[model samples]
Target: MKEGIHPNYRDVLFVDLSNGFKFVTRSCVATKETGKAEDGRELPLFKLETSSESHPFYTGQQKSVDTLGGRVEKFRNKFAAFKK
Candidate 1:
């Protein structure tokens, strides 16, 4: 590994907006915000809409609609006119 040729990889804080869950881990993701951890250490902050903590799939709260009339049909109907 060479110096100065790789993106800055360091610890970053990820916050889940839905549940306000926060965690810090190593990452190279870019952010314009900063936040402090529970220990009072500041780290680059990245906001997220869904994470394993709040995701329906992981939480077992997911609802399944009949594919015949659900998103698949809605999407096909929405763009069907483009086929002509």
Candidate 2:
């Protein structure tokens, strides 16, 4: 609550590049770009690589990794000398 020592907080526009999703929220981050919202209001524009709109977990599109195979292969390699 100190005066003249806090960063400016205002509405900022965050754009998800993957799905072209845009939203406005209050933040203290700095930006040089601006974007217009659905209501025709201009605000600071920030770009993001991933967001809930296109994230695999949020969208229920998670991919399964072959971690079990990797662990089995590593175990076999580590104990191969003992078996010989």
Candidate 3:
């Protein structure tokens, strides 16, 4: 690969803020902070609100969203005439 035209790629510590879970992976994202990984390696810190580990869909905790007055209802109502 060419040099000086690409962002610096290195290991980064991705942390799930909801559960404090952490994992290390290579990334080119920038950060002004640093954190230590499980193996004691200092890496750039990146925070995540939801990862596969903590996501509702992946955790088997997802809920149905077909609620009253929701967008689904609005769509169905608006398109009701077109259905016939």
lDDT of 1: 0.94
Compute the lDDT of residue 81 as modeled in candidate 1.
100
lDDT of residue 63 for candidate 1 = 100
Better of 1 and 2 by TM-score: 2
Clashing pairs in 1: none
Better of 1 and 3 by lDDT: 1
Q: Least lDDT summed over 10 consecutive residues: which range in candidate 2? A: 1-10
The TM-score of candidate 2 is 0.83
All candidates' TM-scores? 0.72, 0.83, 0.73
Q: What is the per-residue lDDT of model 3 for residues 12-55, given as tens digits with 9 covering 90 to 100?
A: 99999999999999999988889999999988999999999999
lDDT measured at residue 82 in model 2 versus the true structure, 0 to 100? 100
lDDT of 1 by residue, 1-84 (tens): 888998888999999999999999999998999999887999999999999999999999999878777888899999999999
Q: Give one digit per residue, the lDDT tens place, for model 2 in 22-77.
A: 98999998899999988899999999999999999999999989999999999999
lDDT of each: 0.94, 0.94, 0.92
